[model samples]
Target: MKVYKQAKIVHETLKRLRVRIDWLQRKLIDASHISTLVERMEGIESARVNKGAKSVVIRYDGKPETRLAVLDFLDRLEPTNLPYVQQSNSEEKHFFHASLNGLALAASPFLTPGQRLALAGALVAPTIWEGIDSLFSGSVKVELLDAIAIGVATSRGDAITALSTNFFIHLGELLEAKTNNNSNALLRQLLHPAPTSAWKEQNGELTKVAADQLKLNDVVAVNPGDTIPVDGQVLSGTAQVNESSVTGESVPVNKEAHMRVLSGTIVEEGTLRIRAVKVGDDTTTARISRFIQDSLENKSETQKKAEKKANQRILITLGLGALTFLLTRDFTRVASVFLVDYSCALKLSTPVAMKSTMYKCAKNGILVKGGQVIETFADIDTVVFDKTGTLTHGELDVIEVESVQPQEWPKDRLLALVASIEEHSTHPVANAVVTNAKAHELPHINHSEVNFIVAHGMVSEVNGKRVVIGSRHFLEEHENVDIAPYEELIIRLENKGLILLYTSMDSVLTGVIGLRDQLREDAKSMIDRLYANGVARIAILTGDRARKAHALAEQLGIKEVYADLRPEEKAAIVQQIKDQGRKLAFVGDGVNDAPALVNADVGIAMPQGADLARASADIVLTDDNISGVAEAYEKSRDTMKLIQSNFKWAVGINSGLFVGASMGWTSPVVSSLLHNGTTLGVLARALSGVRER
Candidate 1:
């Protein structure tokens, strides 16, 4: 096997050399405008043509015998069997050997242009011989052989070319992580903390890890500007980490100690030493990365069924072709049809088109995470969204202020005091109060004995008096404040989708501040377009209450609502949709949406989402608009159509060429030309998507 492989390599090199020299000679003529030389080479007026002296010959049988003789002479100078054979250590000798080797590879009859280029390109590097030797001597050869065999079985059109391309692509993938040259400085920086240990557990579970050390339940300090080295509980400190790459949140959030912190988050501020509860591959980051890698490599159940059917069809066709060829003793004819089936065109076309679309999306400030996600999006029939950060402006605005009597209270003064009490809070209502105070240039009033009622309101003393500012419930339940006449104002604000905050002094409702959450500017238009584009149902899923979800959905023309759901509950809702036989897509931008993104058939996370959410989602919209959801699906569907069209053309043309060859209508040279020409045509069609506006 080694001798045969070596001989074949040598033969191919010489054929490539001849092609290059022939090409260079033509270029020389073009450069100098040598009309007489060209005429002489054509042998127009000569009776006999010189065989080797700047001459050209057109032959019926492709001149294989003549090419073989030239290759035989080159082989005598240096043979693959002889280690480190060299006629001279000069640059010309190296070029001469390389060109000869390329020509020999090209002439092998088994190799195509792509195959020849890939093989010859490898020889230009110094490591080629070492790897080849290693493959021959070590058990690693078995793995390499398996990869090659898989390439052959799974590939269609030009077996050598497919194998060669796969080999180089895989090699590139392997080397990408290790290379740190100047040209790849940015890439190196991005993958510096690359996944080091990826392991599959005995129970068919996979995990990942980056750090060298991890201990059980030890509180690990994940400070600001630091990455979470392991999963742990936030034992101390107040910080908000961006886990968009891992979870997908468009905004950073305030996290206090006692909350569980997953691995792979960028702490924006504050410090929290979390107890290392998960070790090694069990960490969240490792598991997520492993999931992505597995999803990319392992065929989904649907894909497996499709592939099985494709394989059966191909096998049946192969059997029929073989039977026909044996009966007619026409191997060339049989090989032609087998060489150009639609599968190769489909594979290349879909990926190339998808990659191009992804690039286009990036240019437009949208990121479709991967080709696989794009494929899934093309099948979506419904899209669900989160309301607060996703649909609303996420900040409340104080639209109105009212008093018991029309002119009884100074609105600005009342708002100033409310803002003072809520100054230190970060809730939407608190922000609204602060904004109102800022807008009116209200003077600050120092408050003492300030106490926070979680998710209800704030209580404090300002101007040496007790004050209460919060919802109706907070006043009635906590401060025992009465609002007999303020009820009308509160009802009015609620009808407008606003939350009213009542201010009380000494158990009496003094005034009310009406704050409303505004809809996002592009929210309605984007959602409307999505509905027009065949989206049968659209829903809003949020952690907020039912009223909030329903109000946002009503304004955005979304009829469905799933509200007050936790992160895990959101994922369950997505799973329920899938169970109901609906193709569901989720659009979210929070750590809470991570599981939902992973669970949905198609997950479209905002580019601004938390690290975890972005990584979990298959597609990301950088524009942070809901309309991109529809656009992505449209592009994907178009890509799939192009793939199908290219596949049909590739298979159809090859089949016709095979039929022509079988009846002696086409010669070997013509068949070879047609075979490569069809492949080129398919590539051209695939690339046509690039010109799409």
Candidate 2:
């Protein structure tokens, strides 16, 4: 078979690697064979050939030696007629001669005494060498048992048995290492992500800034979801604080003005403005561990327990092999018993499952940073949303148009007249009015040059009449317009939170146009779906006035609302809900609510948010639609289910293989085949992704 003539690495990360193999698309090369061989290489977990791109994507352990080994293996690849590999000429040459030796051993009568011994010795030497190396390590390992098994067969002059056992031992160990390494990498990447940023109060205003920049005695603002970054006394505001990180207290303690708050603690409810007594390494968090290290260093107990069980099972395999030999005095049985190790299947499946789910999340436009984020996301029962862009469209829309004298100045004519004058302006209200006029296909009323007024409305002459379109003050006070008749209509519109724009013809008021920030068309529907899907609690956190914020919440049928909030206070409400044993997922503009996004169990950033805001969040929606929030939550739960299923299948199948090997029901080759077969099977299922069923 033809092999890849050349290779070039294009991109690489700690565990993920992509290489350009220019000759990969050549019809003469066996792409599948190359993939199989590269996957067999130590430290590599998987290899996929992309013929269209003429590249190979490899997942490997990022150790210097492992990376070097991979690079060297591909660089010197040789064309071979071998069944399942494409690698260095020397390795292929050795295996080619070994196969001939294996064939020669098949006809014992044709070989001389010295020749038979030489052939058997060459075939089992690698396995026997590994055994000898392990002997001085002062521990009973799978390597030692493998060597002894092959050695026993060689000593008995069973050349075929010896060679077969040797081959299986090498194959089994490679697969086992690949599986375990892949799983470890998944957990490693999941536990470490990014750093924390907080809001700091300086002078008179709160500025969203990185926590590391604060100095001792600087005032820092702490809110829900915020980890107390410094040891300080509260200058103002009140909050329910969780000091569990430092003091190990389970319940939250109240912190009000003049009360002390320690570093590394979290605000569960309300807000706090504190004077920093300790900052950076001098603070409690740094004393325990640096800020990033403290937050990013985490663990998944599921993987830990699986790993522990896997280690213990290796010893169990050794103990069983020894006991079987003592009971039956059968070398073949003992060798077979030594072939299967649960450590391979048990340790390998978890990471594969995690990586698969992570891929699935990314495919749906949700970027979940790490495994911990996925875990936390799956557990999220409470969702807190920042009011502006998260709940509403975050822009003004023309909602009401009324004419006092409908016969004299029709609603359509009045609206068109105002839009025509306001079209020249670029204010938010003007844009809303002009946009509405376009939607209605209203003809622009021909008017004289529009005179713009700063912070007021536009004035112009329409058909020899001076048309004034502006606020009540501008129309009634400056223009001497008589607007006394529409008193009830203005009050009714004002009570509905609409900003009324008035239009006066000559000196008499004609009509009123109202504008307000409208709710997103999908916002209410998304919330309904969230509750139906499993979100236990939902609340609104806003910088808007209480009346307006509560009004939006009521419109959306939500009860819990935190209104009249500063940017710093938003995350406090998130922390408060999170502290009550409910996992919180905060949806916000992403930048302004930096404190909340950093503090929530899972922070989902809207697509409209700035890049820095998206970077701070655990999950980010690719589209402006808030419906992606429900999609992320649902997908995370499904992924967790897939991981759990993979774990069960791995443990169940490997335990059976372990039993069959112990009972001598399987040969050494068969035991190795079954053990690795189960690993690949579980690995395949993990990569298959979560089926909707």
Candidate 3:
């Protein structure tokens, strides 16, 4: 009823202000009311209340009156007058109380007869209320069955039996709730950013504040081993930042002034001051977290089918129980039939298995977005891979550099001239050339202004002579360079899966640079294993020329190849394959692969992929290992098998119980114990992983 502390200004701007509330008691309802009041005020754009964090961030138009009104409202607010909000810990307390009640009922034999009846009645009260509510709502579910069994026993003067039945059911319900809560908590932890404080710079003085309090343009100092709290640009100092958490790149990148740093990345060595460009929810970490949370909204087809079957079984069980009572004329037999319903196990076990499997997959460096993706992944008959990164290492290596006109230029001189011209470009081929030049310790040559042609190459004047360096198509056709004399060498390189970069000096073909991206070490073995695992077809979809694409496919033993396709074209290929009634899984790791990734039945992304590509993917290989594609498929298939096995056990055991009860071999008490025991057994098996690691 009292404010623990006055509201503190955590963030402020011309049009927004965020205040952290220190409540004497957790007051979610008061926070909600405060948010509503702030939104109703004039000039207020929006107000978000975070009950968990006990804070309200308000966005408003830049007006002095609006700011004054907000301050006045806060100053006059009285916590004692506001509605109280129950804390989340109350749910745990409720569960504890239910557990204690069950335990007390189990010990009822030690109490007096009147005390035993009172305890039984108290335990059955909630079930009766729930059954009546379901009747009014025109729904007959597991609750109705529990109520019927307990009511039948109590009417026959078997209060102990009724209380024991209710206790076991309540215990099962508690366990189910606890399992789901733990699963959800584990998932949230995977995506939630850990709370940390940031050193905020204001007026040339550094003060420690909550990381969430950082606003745009605020400067924060990061030391070695500190996780960067916001996406920002380095203002000063240098460091080697490990970006594996975000980009999945294992190697640490040396970051200096003006370099951009992402949130959630750790600075391995060195210290730096960074200016925040995107803070809180606007940062990359927030976006990934939101994406993960939203992914849970999609339920798998298997889950949907299981839920539907469970509901239908509930109605069937009620009818069967009624028919057994009419035929036998015995209340105990009816109670037995009502006690052994299969719906509870059927409904609860499937989701538990899915969530547990997903958690395991995350631990193994695979991020499956939802249960549906897992189901679909297991069913996929074909897998389409993008060649550049999925099938081969994306990093290009310069294998050969040769001068066509040796009389005019030697190989090293030609390499130096090419590297100098490509120095200003960030293209993969340019990087390969520059890296090769540096490895050979080639001298740097001076060049004039370089003109870059998109998707082709670059042109510049070296030593007062025009020098052109680009793709074969660009140099020969666009630049009118003569490459016919070197056709034999070019053909040989092309056949060997080498990408050629042609260079021309003074309008004459001078040199050719051959670059080759090595196939991933596991690519061939992975493809072989996919086939062995019943993948009907394996194919490669790439933007590379047919010769290059085909050569790699041959090496990997993949028969199908689609070459020289753009982003849209790759997606079209995926659609065409899917139209053939085949479930397809597409694996890719680049910005250009986003469309195809979205178009496929299940998209698998490698680590170190572009943000958009990773976001669009259904499964992410967090370890950057291509082998996870196979591991995911196997895991999903095993998970499905486990679910089906659980289903069979539930049905087989319950059916036996039903027969035994009809023949008067089992009473209501025995039936209730057996039913709950079988269900819990199935749930335990479901929670255990599909296979041993």
Candidate 4:
């Protein structure tokens, strides 16, 4: 090994210093030791060492003299005489030997006594060490049980029994580890890194550069079928972008100049030149990935309960085994009682089942943030849906147009005048009017300067006549246009759940346009399914008028409707429902729905929902289908049932074995076989997943 005196500092400030080591590849242990030493020094706040990159960064709050002393101490330090270590496939090797040892003990008659003893001793060493450590630390668990079983058998000079007990314990450990590792591997596949290269605009030309090299305001050129590497606004060009990875929208949205695009969205067609606004870890994809990782680390209440139950059962089993030994005075009987404990299977199978089901849900385009959300989903009794985007399509369609005076203005002419004014606005109602006009092939009319009044109608001059098109309140209250003649018609249209847009030409009321947002095709079926799956109450919360919300709710057979609610009012309704002791779940897809989504027991977001809504939701539907709510609920329920069954089997079988062993009705070999066999069986069922009906 080469030792250096006074390593060169790469960067330094008053409170931090970064240094590079010449050779530290794959030397995690040495790097950890150095980091620990530096961290223990006076006035050093923290030290981080990266063994792979051979670098260290130290954060200190010391004076200049202390900093110099630290540098001098580093220069005088000598390398330890530790062996150069390389990574090894030790787990695989251990599993292989464990299998062979288990086989040898199962066929003990063919092996000599000395070979069996050696195998037993080797197998029990780790368990004994763990048990001793736990005892010294004032905690005892399942490890103590296994250690006692093997130690008692060894003291009785029964080599075959000792080997058999240790063998089964090791086998069970291997199986549990394998199952958990596989589940984690599947969950990790959800987050993938971005591509390596991007076409960057530099010096009036496009050049290929690494994705990580992108900086703010640096324009990047993207082509068809390319993933957007950064979140930015389109400087030029247009495309159909698929934002399913980040926003969970199934359909590709049309993007044009001045429109914003997010990172991880794909360009299905056309090209786009985007200026990088947020790159690398600041992107939406990165945030979701971090959320998922954090969620995985947080366990559910059900898992914690199972763990606690298992720990309590271990203590009871240990006391029972000691009592049995004292009364019977037989080491073999004590060994038998100690061979079985409930902690292993109960702890391993619950999480395995949850994670496996979560992976399946993700594959089906449902992203559940964590197991706790799944548990809460299964418990929800009341399901609340936002009316606009959750129950019906958020897009508006022009259904009908009528001229107030057919003799004065023809229907086509009236529509053309209204559409010409509405085309200048980007509102949803405006888009519907313009779309309907284009479908009817109405010619565009030339108009003077158009003025848009916020939350009111637009005013402009069409062919030397004044034109106004907007809501009835906007026309009557704001523009002072007389709409007294069409009050009956407005009332009828409003009763039919249609939004009306009034038009005035030359200071005379001309016509009214009716627009309606259609209910989703699966809305009724989804509601029925949710009810069938044990949802006690299904309600609608909307910012729409009372008549509109009631009209749509009646169609879907939903009785409870909260209308004209502000964002905070929706959250208040959720809190009221929750206060009644009903577990509630809110499904929404708009920024206004974010408060309610956050207030519910579980929040579900549609794929096409706003980013804020998705972030507030616990579950996100990737296909933007409302029916996924039922699917997620049913899946969570089934996963919980599977967990319960596994828990029952683990406890029932272990208790039975413990009772038989205490009464001296089972031998040590039989006890180990039954206990490990039950654990393996439960694990197999968990990994196999909930059965499909």
Candidate 5:
């Protein structure tokens, strides 16, 4: 708290606070870090630090508690408290190793045969060491095959062949290393968690600090709307926590003192003080996020198969080389036989294709999380979409307004009355009504105390008449309003996928408001494109009623539909589809969709989706465009197609060369050039799209 003692509050307001710090004049503290730290606290919007005036200005949401929290954070921050950022130079390592290998190859013509052989040996030392290590370890792999080939070339004083083979091997290493590094970097960006801070309660006082700084056994205070920062037992207070991210449950669980709580769950209501038993990287959120990050290193089935094929081919090459040398007593044939293995192209082409496609997808506003996701997308047979946000605009709009009794209540007046009542609540349907009324410049009508009912509607007294605005169930059943006369109109609207809100005045139906999500203009076209690209089945899942969900599916020409489902039910359906031996992809955009997103073979999250949804998804569209899913599907197939083509080309040509060398038909120089030439050519084809302009 050394820095805190020297700082003073200079100006204060409901939404803005300015603080003076003396150390900023001397450049002793990191102002950028301070701004980022304070701005992440709940209710804070921005923090600007001024090094010249030695002051920090913070703008926060207009909440009294938020103002207190900002000051608390600044008061507890110390001079030594700043996050350390490490810089990565894998790109530099790639360049440096590449320069050395390039020099060895390019300078070969200027040296004598003996000098060339010596230099090639130095350059190929690592591969030879790896081969010797693998030899003792009793494993036959591509590295051992490559080392033996180069070793035979050197033993026979064939420097050009030795240098050529070693150079191409290094080239493939550089390609795979560079691609893996860049993929991991992009995944890190997409997997970053929401800004987090915690309130540490010690000795009867609360202090705000970065969540990562929390220690085991530290007591933390969490409020409504705050993400819980630890996996621990609640020390005091009570709250309802949404554990959907972990348990896949739609309902928030009630938590009280002595109950256990997990990190990443949000406090929906009330407050709680928790004692942290696990902190920092040990928490569940970090572990799950790490699981996502592990995708960067985990190889896909295609990559494994490629490496397996390469390793299996190594034994064939070694056996052929030994047989030829034993039969003909010729070292040249032995070197040619050893150099003609299919290891290089088979092992390197898959990574090159995967990395190139990832870069392409990123540029096209799609982020394929890993090579595994790309592999899955290549074979995806089924696609499931969340109805509201995935297929149509998540925002509801007023499609039509009709008055049941026009003689007593007109449409405009009904809209205004509904808007006035609905504006008091913040539901999506209510917001649409309020927005439509405002667009027409309608004034708010005076009403009695508005009572908001959960999952029903709004009720109040307007002009001394009991007025209710809600659904058919709320008005007809709950309020005893008679709406049996307009049953046909209701049915027609529901058939068209319009969600209706019924209004009643004094036990009589007065009006109906039809609200519906506007379908994305390209939705149908996107579906058609999916079908054209070989998707076998398409379906929709929604929490909406069966009528509305069916109406949307029919409009989109989709035959399969699941409706009125909770979050867990949606996930169950996804698993069921997957269990049928169908390769499925699920697209979603809400916090409740996390479970299904996780369960699908490949999950695609819309860019505007909630944090948990994006984190759970394997593929994320970086833009709002829904058609990117179709684009990604096409790209994945093309990349896999390229890999397969290269696999065939490598095997077909190298097998011919191996047979020629066994018959002493192809020389060592011809074998090395043709083998490395095809390997480099296919690798170039795989990386053709990834080149920067």
Candidate 6:
């Protein structure tokens, strides 16, 4: 068994060595053109002083056929007397010795066959000869014999030798490992496998459905800590979802049945069984994932154009280098240049930079989902916004209520009654009513049998009295309450973008409470800054009526408005802007704006939005500030610029080295060192982050 184990170890080493030899042989063979130079050039001349003090007759003829003529002369020379050859230059001394050295060494009887073969091959192979030249040529030189020994060590599989040859390879693999594992892990995870979703069989069948099939009402289920797989309505159970990955909100939210959830959100609590109203490809989650994948697969238009130019330039240079090498028979130098020029730098740099920039944005609470989004932000001709909650604080302020029977019920009692009924509802309206009621110090009403109406209002019995609080239409249609006269008050609030709710007791109008969504403190300033940052236009799209949307748009200096838009309509509007040569970025609390979010060049979600929207957006704002958008753009532009610079340096150095090598100005050792240096330099530069403005 021990013998068998030893045999196995030897076999494995042999196999590994075989692989290395194959790789080296392939590369060296590709470089063999350089070795022919020695066979094609020759020195034959005699120039010396005679004792008679007469000018010595020096015969010299340097021509392309000189090497052939010298060979013919050698074949005819007599072997009886001692042969003495003369040379005119020191370079010729080394060149002549190199050619004859192999034959002389091979003729020796003392040296082993392996040693003889190795020495003979070294004399003729440009690679080996160049190694000698490198070590002996300049001030920055090692001994010629030392270089040969090192090259032998490398060829013979010495660990240190392998390390020297593989410096750039190992460094690149290490840096790529670090990058793929840490900062860009998320993007890499999404991109590395090409997604099981995009997998295709040999047959023409598609493996996955497109994303748009997923709908809001679909039943979906995702376990704890898992990303929400699809967008759907929660049918049962409660859990806190960490939407920060999608929406940039660090805080987790409590979500229950009937609440809409999005994809890419992590479930932080109890299991949820959701009803998938949309499935297959149309779902919002699928669309968002599709966008991310597409962004990764497709370069921006500008990048594609740049790559085309770069590729053409590289091809032209390679062609020129090849032609020159063939004409001059300078195979040694040709090999050096070919080894140094790799297309990876130009091909990979920009995409990596863009990916890293996007990650940086995620770190700072902004998530730009795709390359398209980053490019779009760089050219945002117009900006649009939703008024309520987006521009305004989204919090409702309750100042006062005009009671129908002022003497009959105190305002505090009426608000308390309304708040008790609204406690079970989760809408912004409910929160406003509840907060205002608490602030007034009104006695809490013990309410029972509460019922909620989706997108409308709520109802409950307080002290055996039917209390109602909601939209006027909700009360008038459901309870047969007369709300015509209340229209005047509703109109007044509507013009200011405030949603009005009517309160009634047993079908009798008690009073009307006006709820206003206050403006965010930073709304105007953030919008102005976005404008100053080269944003060309700003607009708002919302489900609310035009009057209210327009009112808030005016306040925020927005010039465009689209109100009372269904989710599909909003998406169409976004598409329209995109069609008009403007890159649209939709920022919303994800719940009601999903389609539009997906339609925009970039979907930006706030922490407060539904999980689905966060997942749909490329960028999530952690602090929910609009200014984060601009900051993200700045980082992206800078990172991309660095990527371009890295490519330029990488390609430039390699191309320059190729020229140097071809001219015989560079030796094997120098070329190898340069190749390693250029590659490592490019990677290092790419890793460096952009400076802050």
How badly does each model clash, as a count of residue pairs? 44, 5, 0, 0, 0, 36
Model 2 clashes, total count: 5
Looking at candidate 4, the ten consecutive residues that score lowest on lDDT are 81-90
Candidate 5: regions farther than 4 A off: 1-130, 153-292, 326-328, 362-369, 446-456, 459-466, 477-480, 518-522, 566-580, 589-599, 605-617, 620-625, 656-670, 688-693
lDDT of 6 by residue, 1-693 (tens): 212211111112211210011121221121111111112212435322222222122233545344333333322222121111111112223434434543443354666656554554444344345546764665212122223433444455332322232332233434443443233334432211101111112244433322233444544455575456565678788999986645557789899988877555668888887665545354443444444444455566655755665555555545655775787875445544444444445544555666666656655656466666677677666666655556766777775576777787777777777887787887777788888877777777788888777777777876677887777888888888997876776677677766678888898888877776777777787788777767787888888888878877888788788999887888888888888988777888747777877887777776556767766776766555766766866676666668667866876787787678677787544665676566556655554556655
TM-score of each: 0.57, 0.63, 0.77, 0.79, 0.67, 0.56
- Top of the candidates by TM-score: 4
Candidates 1 and 2, the one with greater lDDT = 2
Q: Model 2 lDDT vs. the true structure? A: 0.71
lDDT of 4 by residue, 400-477 (tens): 888987886788888888888889899999998899999999999899999988888799997788888888888788
lDDT (tens digit, per residue) of candidate 5 on 1-693: 223465588998778878987776544454555675576567889999887798999998989767766665676656653332212323444455456667877998899877988887787777678888888898887667667777877877777777666666565556655544444343333232333578899789999887878999999999999889898899899999987554335579899988788787889999999999878776755654554444445578999999998988888888888888889998878877877878778877787678667756765667676688889999999999998888887888899899988887889998999999999998989989999999999988999999988899889999999999888888877889888888899888888889899999998999899988878888898999999999999999999888888888888899999999999999999999999999999999999899999999999998667778977998877556788888899888888887888888888888888889888898766776677677777777776633331
Instruction: Give the 10-residue window scoring lowest on summed lDDT in candidate 1.
Output: 180-189
Which has the better lDDT: candidate 3, or candidate 6?
3
Candidate 1 overall lDDT versus native: 0.56
Candidate lDDT values, in order: 0.56, 0.71, 0.80, 0.80, 0.79, 0.57
Greater TM-score among 3 and 6 belongs to 3
Show the colliding residue pairs in model 2. Answer: 223-572, 224-571, 224-572, 225-575, 268-576
The segments of candidate 4 whose C-alpha lies over 4 angstroms from its true place after superposition are 1-112, 115-119, 209-218, 232-262, 267-270, 275-278, 323-329, 406-417, 440-455, 459-467, 477-481, 589-594, 606-612, 659-667, 691-693
Across 1-693, the per-residue lDDT of candidate 1 in tens digits comes to 212211123113322322112221222122111221222121122111122233232221235543443323222312221111112212223344435444544564776666654554444233334334546774232123223322332233343443333333233223321121111121111111212222222234334322444567654555566666666677778998876644445478787866666666667888776677776666654544343333233333333433454444455445545665787765544544344233333334444455455545544445555556666677788888877766775678888887653364477677777888888897878887898889889998778978887887777886666888788888888788777655666766676666778888878788888776777788898888777767787888888878757766788888899888888999998898889888888888889999998999888776445768877877766554555666676777776667667666766786686577566576433544455556556655655554442
> Over 4 Å off in model 6, which ranges?
1-298, 319-342, 362-370, 386-413, 421-431, 439-441, 445-492, 504-510, 517-529, 566-572, 575-580, 587-632, 647-668, 688-693
